[model samples]
Target: MVVLPMKEGDFIKIEYDAFVKETDQLMDTTHEEVAKEHDLYNERATYGPMSVVVGSGTLIKGLEEALKDAEVGKEIEVEIPPKDAFGDRDPKLIEVFPMNRILSLPEFRKGDQYPAEGMEIRINNRTGVISRIFAGRVRVDFNNRWAGRTLVYKFKVTELIEDRDDRMRALISSVYPHSEEFSFEFGDEDAVDIILPDIVKLDTNWAMAKFKLISDLRKYMDLRTIRLIEVYMKREEEEEHDHGSEHSHEHDDKAPAEKGSEGEKKGEEPSENKEASTDGEEKADEKKE
Candidate 1:
């Protein structure tokens, strides 16, 4: 059986090693050893074949275009020009900020030291690196690190995913890359259900993250319902009771009634004796009359 060349809308997993063409600096790789050597080892990251939707912007334009005719199990080394890779570096992205302005950021405190050169900082919702600091001013560069540099990638297609389960897994991995575990259920009516791990459910950004994940998944698969399930065990919380003082007050109120009942019982014999004496006097007076 002959496998067709990769085309748009196909999902493929590939093992790739990328480098800067000019400097030969390793930019990215799937191999664990290479990542360790480059001090980029992330224990949480999945250091293996990565999934990509062919026409999706999951990859740079050049790399995605190269995969159009790529074959499985065959290594291909492609050189991408700066224009097609990260784009030419623009001087406009390098802006200067006053020392006072930099100090006024939310991350900075009144007595905190100002950011130094080579430090990354967020300003106006954009992240930039401090390239220079002098004369009460700082230069922040917002350009991509690889901008104005060509990129070289050696990659091979490891697997072509067609199974619905694998495709769903790929979609999840793309969105929640560091997710621990998740399961999927497809119904007869084209509805989908995803059971996320407990850890993911605890994320603070879960509301926004879930929305983006569902949006990305819908781009590839049509579904009537997508249920994202997160189950959590509720901690047994003890209800705070303020009835201690109230109960004591109730006991105090009942004490008078209890004492009155005891007094009535104690006085019953004297009252009966007095009534008997009165009845005898009345009978003696009637006989005398």
Candidate 2:
């Protein structure tokens, strides 16, 4: 299939699987129902590029580095060496802490984990926290659980689609499925009743995700079918969860990433905000009949 450059906002479609080096058996994957106990679950691992922000820390370091050179919709095979993928068993990473530290915390279960503070945690899997007490010291290995394994990844990119407005609507729906947040506005000063919730602040990245979705929706004329919707920004809660936290915490289920929420990035400078916002308004106006 034809491959395109993976733009910053391009929606990536791809599949990945990890194979055992010795047996070539498909040990684990991201596709099927992952047991509460394994690395990858399905024989074939697959996930959307939505879960990954390119050049970011979503995938393995080697994979990330490899994909940087990868174009969107381009299928490529990359072999990540153990050292590049996870790294040789870092002798320094393994540690023996005072057993009291492990036994003291009520939340310190064998498999439970928290930030090592500046330490990174791999997404989609439980942190490996095997706490064994020996000679008054608790052995804790901070190295990646699959540190010594070689991985062969085949990325068959389906397509590189732009993030558009439908994607934005979908994103809003994803975040606030229970609440209704859509309305139509007739051009030339018509106000429609909008039940915008107590606002939730958005970080720059999330805002961009929403912006791109809007753009894509416009491209498809999906928004044209409706009158108009003026999306206003508000900060509903003073408290905001770190977007990164969304990945680390185990939600009841993995909320499927929908294709929506496209527009622009949030940034500093109020004067520019007025200009960029007008651009968004113009976008809405462009859809007006």
Best by TM-score: 1
lDDT of 2 by residue, 205-247 (tens): 4455445534443443235432223355544442354554665
Clashes of each: 0, 29
Q: How well does each candidate superpose onto the true structure, as a TM-score?
A: 0.74, 0.42
Summarize candidate 1's per-residue lDDT along 19-133 as a digit string, tens digits: 9988888999999999999887888667889987787678899988888667888789999999889999999999999999998887776666668888889998999989999
Q: Candidate 2, 24: how far from true, in Å? A: 5.8
Q: Model 1, residue 99: displacement in angstroms?
A: 2.2
Which regions in candidate 2 have their CA more than 4 angstroms from the true location? 5-10, 20-28, 33-53, 65-77, 107-128, 131-133, 166-289
To one decimal, what is the Cα RMSD in angstroms of model 2 from the true structure? Answer: 28.1
- Residue 188 lDDT in model 2? 30
